[model samples]
Target: MTTADALYTVNVTINGQPHEVKVPARRTLVDLLRYDLDMTGTKETCSVGVCGACTVLIDGEIAASCITLAVQADGANITTIEGVANGEALHPLQQSFIDHGGFQCGICTSGQIVAAKSLLDSNPSPTEDEVKEWMMGNLCRCTGYYQIMESILKASK
Candidate 1:
């Protein structure tokens, strides 16, 4: 059997829920979130890590889920895009995106929102430059990024 044939159990806390899942060692965190947990909010684009399309909060820090192996996050707390909001109440950033038109095509919105949420959690009130620097990793093929930066800054308030 190859390394991919070896399955391991990963125990993690996702969005405040405890889970024990068995997965191949090669399975990335994005796959675990999207396929196993049905958390499709975390988009997978640029399969590589640089694009930030699969950004997730692992232990309250930003991570590229597409490049992160599920086994690597064992025993950690993970917050996907789905976990950022209350049941029906939209997260401020989410609302800001809609209000400010932060997205188009909607592919990169979730990761952008999740990443911006992390920034806000760290610095509740970031300056415009900080918002741009913080969000520079997440790319949007649709918007010019001015609106996304505005959304993040506005939500930071």
Candidate 2:
């Protein structure tokens, strides 16, 4: 089939909701989430996946949605920032971020929280160094690393 006609059927569970969408073969998971599903919490920055701005939990592991194909995420459980909070109440990480000034410009906050949530899920009560190490891939151009670290640390408690 031609590239223009190449389409993929993806069945994914996002934020505890099931979604089935037909997307182009070239569609990225970020696009599918943002465009098709109207879930905009996952941001795309540096599109190469190095910046980690598009990080999301796929089956409880951090995955770069910008670099991941929507088709590749089939049958996966995806969690974005929208899914992190419990209704009107914020997730501990989100509250900690707000309380600790973990975000400045806010462009990277979603990915940062998502990544931090993954870390905490796997390794609750991680050391400060572990938080730093795990969060290194998520870059904040606003240079709010210390506060971000503090937020994660506080949330772990």
Candidate 3:
């Protein structure tokens, strides 16, 4: 693809699996993850990046995949919601969410989980206020965020 065509082949490591796919230079990382690769774990609500529904970890750092371009993620290690849990045993955060009634509609659960993973990775034990502030990016319209915050804090403990 020519430079003017805005197309490029990007190699990304997703969930420890290497994937090489041709994507438009302008294609968002979320689109590539969801559409091209059939990884629907990444949710997309607000396309502009204000909402954290499209959150994912790039090299263990939280990023909004919706606004991030696929090309930008080239050669990066990405972890989506799919990567958080194993086959049957849920991640500590997931288990906490279930135990604390963190999710209601579940649309925002993916982002919440991914964000909580980022938090837990950095600080295993986070206070309730810290959990609320850290998870501010993820918005849950149905749960009112009470249960979600409780879940993250509980997981930290």
Candidate 4:
């Protein structure tokens, strides 16, 4: 097989669980998560990295999985939206989103929450401007931004 079709073995710890799989070298992390691993929470909206729909945490840093190759994630720790909550219990950010009406169509909800979680992890007491600036990268077409800000701010308290 040509290099384009070559499959490489990948081992990654996702959500604290170890996983091993062989995938095409060109397979994106998002595809590996959504398709191969059946993790549909990370959406593939713009295909490119502009839209934060495929946002995930790689080694605790927020990254756009759509632009990240699966092979690049070998031996890395990945955290998808599925990893954000405990069994039958929602994360504070998730609960805040629901209570504050942070989502409308819900396409960007997962990404927004993931990104927000990352933001909170790094800056637990960020100001409103900080939250707005941090969340600017994530787009929400249906719902307004006020609710999202409220959710993050409320969750921080």
Candidate 5:
């Protein structure tokens, strides 16, 4: 078989649901989620990890899905934006974002929320400086940092 034909099997638990999928060796975790599994909440912008637009939780830590290989996520527990909310109720961050106007244009909202969730999960009550430092990697073209910061701070309370 050619190099392009090499495939790997990844058994991942996404959004608390288990899934086993066959993917090419080169398949990125973002692509696997978006195409193979139809989970598109994770966006791919910079493609590089610098943008943080493709951030997701892998084993409870924030990860850049666009740069992570699907095979690297084998046997891992992943959480995407789609998995953040309860059955019908929105996650606190989701609701806070809406209430606080944390997003504009909405391209970077998912990543911002995911990263903010990670911060809150680790530090339930972080200072403003801490929140700013943690979210520096997530860039919003709409310049909505103030509202985004407000959302995280509000959700922390």
Candidate 6:
């Protein structure tokens, strides 16, 4: 293939597995995961990155996958919502979300899980207000934020 038609190969560690995938320069990380790799746990809501529905953990830091290019993820370790669970057992945050009614329609659960995982990783003992502030990037039309906050707080404890 000519340089103009060449595809870029990006080597990335996703969910603890190393992968070398060919992606175009314009492809976003969200598409790379969801479409190419079939990792559907990372939801794509606002493609513009404002909704945080495409959030993923890049080397343990939460990032907006919708706005991040797949090429930029080369040599990086990425964790999606699918990676948070331990086989059949749900992660603490996931269980908390269920136990505390953190979701309604469940469209935003993936993003919420990713964002809450970031918060819990950094501040394992976050206060109620801290949970609200850190999770502001993810928006859920249902539950009105109270149950979400409660779930995060419960998971932290």
Please report how far candidate 2 places residue 1 from its true position, in Å. Answer: 5.7
TM-score of 1: 0.95
- Summed backbone clashes in each candidate are 0, 0, 0, 0, 0, 0
RMSD of each: 1.5, 1.2, 1.4, 1.2, 1.2, 1.3
The stretch of ten residues in a row with the least summed lDDT in candidate 2 is: 1-10
lDDT of 5: 0.94
- Tens digits of per-residue lDDT for model 5, 1-157: 5687888889999999999999999999999999999988899999989988999999999999999999999999999999989989999999999999999899899999999999999999999999999999999998999999999999996
Q: Give the TM-score of candidate 2.
A: 0.96
Model 2 ranges off by over 4 Å: 1-4
Q: Which candidate is the best by lDDT?
A: 5
Q: For model 6, how does the per-residue alpha-carbon lDDT over 1-157 read when each residue is reduced to its tens digit? A: 3676568999999989898999888889999998889988888887998988888999999999999999999999999998899999999999999999999988788999989988888889998888888989899977558898888888996
TM-score for candidate 5, residues paired by index: 0.96
Ranking by lDDT: 5, 2, 4, 1, 6, 3
Write one digit per residue (lDDT tens) for candidate 4, span 21-127.
Answer: 89999899999998899999998899888878889999999899999999999999999999999988999999999999999889888999999999999999999
What root-mean-square deviation over C-alphas does model 2 reach? 1.2
Residue 142 alpha-carbon offset, candidate 3, angstroms: 1.2
Q: What stretches of model 5 exceed 4 Å from their correct place?
A: 1-4
**Reference-based lDDT, each prediction:** 0.91, 0.93, 0.89, 0.92, 0.94, 0.89
Which should have the higher TM-score, number 4 or number 6?
A: 4
Q: Which pairs clash in model 3? A: none
The ten-residue window of minimal lDDT in model 4 covers 1-10
Q: Residue 94 error for model 6, in Å?
A: 0.4
1-157 per-residue lDDT for model 3 (tens digits): 3676766999999999999999888899999999999999888998988878889999999999999999999999999999998977799999999899999888888998999999989989888778878888788888568788788887885
